[model samples]
Target: MLFLTIYPKLHVVFALVSTHMADEDATTTKLRDRSHIDNTLRLTTAEPTPEFSAALKKLQNIYHSAIKPLETAYKYNELRTHEVTDGEITSKPMVLFLGPWSVGKSSMINYLLGIHDTPQQLYTGAEPTTSEYTVVMHGEKSRTVEGIVMAADNSRSFSPLEKFGQGFLERLVGIEMPHKLLERVTLVDTPGIIENRKQQERGYPYSEVCQWFIDRADLIFLMFDPTKLDVGGELATLFKQMKGRESQIRIILNKADNLATQDLMRVYGALFWSMAPLINATEPPRVYVSSFWPSEYAADTNRQLFIQEEVSLLEDLNQVIENQLENKIAFIRQHAIRVRIHALLVDRYLHTYHEKLGWFSDPHEVFEDIVSDPDKFYIFKSILAKTNVSKFDLPDKEAYQDFFGINPPSGFKQLSSHCSWTSGCLIDNIEKVISVELPALLSSLGKKETPPPAKATPAPPPPLPETKPKNRWRKD
Candidate 1:
């Protein structure tokens, strides 16, 4: 300690345990202790000279000797066990209704679905509302609740997951008929990520939970009561993690029924500009304040007039919804393209795995490892450019015959034979998407649909270099 203190140049070491590390036997224990000591030494010791650094490196080897039997592990498990994803799973994309508590996440959900139903047997007001992560799936088969359930609404501790249930919120409802807008997507009603003393006590910000959803979400409508929008820090994290992460995560400046029009414009302008940097927008950030609230005291004295404003706002809302829908479809299409590219990628480098790679675990584990590597996308992009694929545009239908098989089923053959078909589909889903599904969705977000961009044909590649006889090939 004294040597470290006296010589600013010295390198010293120390060790600390990682509660998250999975392999902690005598070997892992020793390695972690060594890591702490090494970091301590690096912090101390007489100014780290080339010789001291080498000595420190040797000490690390001794500390982790126990892991030698596990030939594949490089170090701790936290760095290794976590999943990195570049594609969607079978799960439907999540649509979260997020905001500070009492800003009406539940009410908005009800309004969006146009329902008055709540949990069963409990008075509508008594049942838990949006106190946990409530997932709504269809309920055509002898369901209990007409559509909503508030049976369980509690926070789950997250230092590590508690026994699946003890502290977590549970979903109690099966969705019935829904607001037309929800027809194509799964709706996730997240427990308020703020002011739940129980959640914050568990050592994670509610914001992180919200972020996890945004990270996977194909469409996100982030609600905000203008009053709390100024709250800082977490918004930055939210923006950093989600800004343009998906084009559909739009800010729903909710309860616009609260602000004066002139004041609303002034404040919203400032707030939008402030958050603009967090989103990947070349234009200023876009937001829609809803005077959708029936009351008058809040902002947007114009909301009660939603009836009067219906014709105009409806037209406007349709355009917005279309834009958001386009973004959502585009995000999913891009994800599909990535999976195709990754399939091509693994095929190109299958030899690196050990000779006896287990069919069940090896493919997934290797896929996880490769995707987690930060450079994975860069490599994937290079491969995609070579393969002639684009996330925004599907490859030509001809590209799929060898992929899907030279002889597909009759149904698929019909699809493939379309002169304009691509990747086994009738046509690129997104192009038709703009004219169909997107109009309603973007209308909800206040974006107008411009005509889709005209498709272009690629020019043929330059003729290949002419070959010459080897004996006479030299240029004069």
Candidate 2:
């Protein structure tokens, strides 16, 4: 409201005084400067008239009004004494471990999650302990006795994911952290894509959830029990649902602890060739052999040694999870890139104005310049309307491909180029998007903000206040 009141009162200088000194091409150059705007509409900064004096005074006062409060707010936030600890998602991901009912999904999850008593049967029985999606977030480790809402009907019912997203995106943007994999990548444990027959016949309640998630999932760790590794039927159908898209889709050979040494080799080879027709896997899925239930022989182990090495996983703590962080960081780096692009011209035009205007000059003059180019301002508004801040996701594979047409790289160079993709790409993208929108912004400014050229009768300057010449040597 304040900006609106002040903007019209100020003037857009055509700098007529400098025209006589400029070269012959000055007229052509000034006219050709429309590269920034396809249609250049000139509004002569007419010589000051009687009414101009009051408007100039009010416009100058607008600058006077804006400075102090903005300065005070900046100082208050910068000098805070205590800083809170906020790096939860970066340390532990909100991993959602999901799979078929009997695939040892919870068993390996508990192992990786480090929730165990070490061989006295931590999970009394491991026959798919989690049938519904669950989100396990960061909490005090001492209390492995944490909160767990094991199952829910509505997919978006759980609120932890929402809060986690808010905190994670905020941290990622605030830190400008380089690690791109993910700081707030929530590990969502979803129901497995069951056999297509089950989806067709009984109509698995969550197949819709599965498809929706696959379309939006950051990474999918598909579990293929060793027994079914050689058979491509189930795997192929799941692959069909989420194929061609790039990033993370890992195949885990669960229940490898159930397979024999030679059979394990056979299943691995067979699954690779069998599924080659369906899933375009860069690498064969990650295969792990281990029981969700601890082995019988490990039952007699001493508590301290077992707890130190296996239960608490304290011995090789850093080494165990160090490699995974790289993947997670890559996801978040992408998010920062989008936020940076939110407005390209607004950032550049304002900065350029500030650089020229300098200190002691008002900053509102910079935005006033934006409103000055009502054409440009309209262009920016049109482009911004197309973009929604909520939709940019670096970690989720499908959004990159479908929403914005960016997909994960198949090779390490693809990763490297993307990781180092210029800070200016967002701006470049906006420039391209708004080229079509420039005329709109320009037309708007022309109507609401830009002024028409001077009229045929040039207006005379308003007279200054009159004062009688002081008598010589008069001092009060």
Candidate 3:
């Protein structure tokens, strides 16, 4: 009985070990394929404004000459250089439209673009007809770009969307039109937020993808109909993500024309009560109460208010072009911070790994020697097995191996040396660009005069000599 029980347990243990090994192999293969994909699917850069172009080139030069080589040398896996640089340096001002079905999102977009007669515009309907994320951009003529082609175009922001998997890719569409408004703004229409649990059953990571767009958007328009002003489930979660971005968000109370003046007030008040907690704002966000011109079935009795709101919205949208440079600079600054943090973390790990490996008596000397003979860098494996890393912190073993593995020893050493030297330079350059150079440039562009230097106050004259003693004797 002892032998039988022990044998069964041993078999189970063997099976688990085999399964783990198989999983590891699969992960390794996947990582390798991903690297290959990245290498082959390099995107073309987008055409940005002159100022943005110059700044972008500076950043690109820094990465290519500094960060890239260092990351390669240290065998760091969380490379985001492409994410920082791939799209146009000067991205167009983006206005993202989000709401539930029948909130008049598509109708508003069409009205803004003045596409009354065109069937080529966004498909507007009463039901939840838009099931995809549609990107509307400026073009010479109206046309639709398939998701796959859009993914292949490195110049577009949608290039990154490819990684969300085929299910998401299948649900994406790009519309390019010859609209004067699009020349200054890109409008993004997202899928209507469904309240049901069935949305969760969708294979794609919906919230994650939406968050990506939210972070990049210059402004967000949250639409709500008076009839359906609910903010629950996925919508609630999305609003929570907009915590710090409250200033850039505008609440739109659509279909106000359908309600009587008193009822509209009631609905508006109710919306404020419901959204105040969700938005968590000290002051309620600006709400544009208007109906899209084409949707006149529920015409507003208060035509003046509707016209004023529409005009104000358009003016706000136009202001984005004027502030484009500021937005781009801000983006670059944020990207720099991310890169700096990544470099510091990788540097720490490399130092620890070298120390553990007993590569040299001094940790600094280890990198120096490694630079001379990169082939010996494969010795990293010995330390990797012993290293403890959190899953959330960095890429896993397979990803690391795919990026840093399979190189000839000499090539590895050379890359290591190159990266070390470049990373040092990169860190310094990035600091200068973000902290010192960019500020002065921006100040000059804004045409604000620098404050005159304050004059130094002269030191008080030396105390009069012997006056104190003379006064004491006289007073007595």
TM-score of each: 0.45, 0.37, 0.68
Model 3, span 1-476: residue lDDT tens: 68658799786667557744743443244110111111111111112346555655665564455444445554443453235434645457789998887687887787666674478767765556788889999889889988888887888877887888888888888899876557667899998888875655666888877887887888899999896777787788989878767877888888677678788899989998887778877767778887663533333377656655655565555445556666766775655554444454444445444555573466445544553443365433433333232224343334333433343223333213332443455556555655766566566446533223324433332222333212111112
How many clashing pairs does model 2 include?
Answer: 24
Global local distance difference test of model 1: 0.40
lDDT of 3 at 260: 81
- Lowest-lDDT window of 10 residues in candidate 3? 32-41
lDDT minimum window of 10 residues, candidate 2? 32-41
lDDT by residue (tens digit), candidate 2, 1-476:
57645664442122222322331232234110111110111112322233333332332232223221222222211212111111321234333344555465555444443343433112323233443454434332222211222111122223222223332222111111211122223345554435544544422334444554464444565666666443435555667767643334555555554556578778878766776777665755433333332322133333222222231211112222222333323332222233323223234333444455767776566545544453444534443455543333212322222312221111112111222244323334333323433223223322332234645544332221244322221122
Most accurate candidate by lDDT: 3
- For residues 329-413, could you state the per-residue lDDT of candidate 1 as single tens digits? 4443343344334333333223223322466665546634443452443444554565446554433223332322332121122
Q: Which candidate number maximizes TM-score?
A: 3
Better candidate number, 1 or 3, judged by TM-score: 3
RMSD (Å) of each candidate, 1 decimal: 26.8, 35.2, 22.1
Which residue runs of candidate 3 sit more than 4 Å off their true CA positions? 1-82, 295-300, 358-424, 448-476
| Candidate 1 residue runs with Cα over 4 Å from true position | 1-95, 116-129, 136-138, 141-186, 195-212, 215-218, 294-300, 303-332, 352-385, 389-476
